[model samples]
Target: MSSAVVGLLIQELPKGGMMMTRTLILGIAATIVAAPSGAFADTPAGNQQAQNTSDAREIVCRRMPPPAGTRIGPRNICRTQAEWDLLQQQNREEVERQQDASHYSRGN
Candidate 1:
């Protein structure tokens, strides 16, 4: 509960000045509650943050999803294992082509 600060001019402030006072107090109270605490619990070093393996693994993790997200039926293109296999095969072939191009570009 926030107590109000009544100002120097009480009557001249206007009608319902007490309500305005309480509103200002409540706003300040909410601000204090929402603020981040000054003290932080143990955090990794700044450079080490970018080096975390979890971020690296996400690129691979995103390739596949839960089995339920597949199998809405035959109408859905990637709903079956065959479709996923084909997708992976295409991606592998494209990667190989890129690598072969790079190998020739380097005169290897």
Candidate 2:
């Protein structure tokens, strides 16, 4: 049923209903109200992990100068922690590769 009807029923439950019935209706109503919008799988552990991972997906952000001719002010750049770490690793590897190439070319 609709949320409005469930809400009205909950409001009216305390007036004259038995305590057990009221609790049952309240529990059902709460389940309906708190249900997640999307379909859920039966994997409880996986669901909790996924929920925690999504919740932890905050980004590391910085204000950097805009690219040439784009703007005069700084722009915000953001990346997830994992992405930032991977980017740093790749940059280090590239720098090392360039250094190795330079050393070889210099006959060292």
Candidate with top TM-score is 2
Model 1, 23: alpha-carbon shift in Å?
2.3
lDDT accuracy of residue 54 in candidate 2: 72
Deviating ranges (above 4 Å) for candidate 1 = 1-15, 38-108
lDDT for 68 (candidate 2): 89
Writing each residue's lDDT as its tens digit, candidate 2 over 1-108 gives 477876677677656656777678778877876686445635688788887677557688978887789757898889886677778899999999998888765454
Q: Model 1 over residues 1-108: C-alpha lDDT tens digits? A: 223432443334567677776567568766775564534544678856665544433433223443676763433232344445567899999999998888775454
Each candidate: what lDDT?
0.56, 0.75
TM-score (all chains, Cα) for each model: 0.28, 0.40
Write down the TM-score for model 1.
0.28
At residue 41, what lDDT does model 2 achieve? 39
Candidate 2 clashing pairs, residues 3+ apart or interchain: none
TM-score of model 2 relative to the true fold?
0.40
The stretch of ten residues in a row with the least summed lDDT in candidate 2 is: 34-43
> What's the true lDDT of residue 105 in model 2?
55
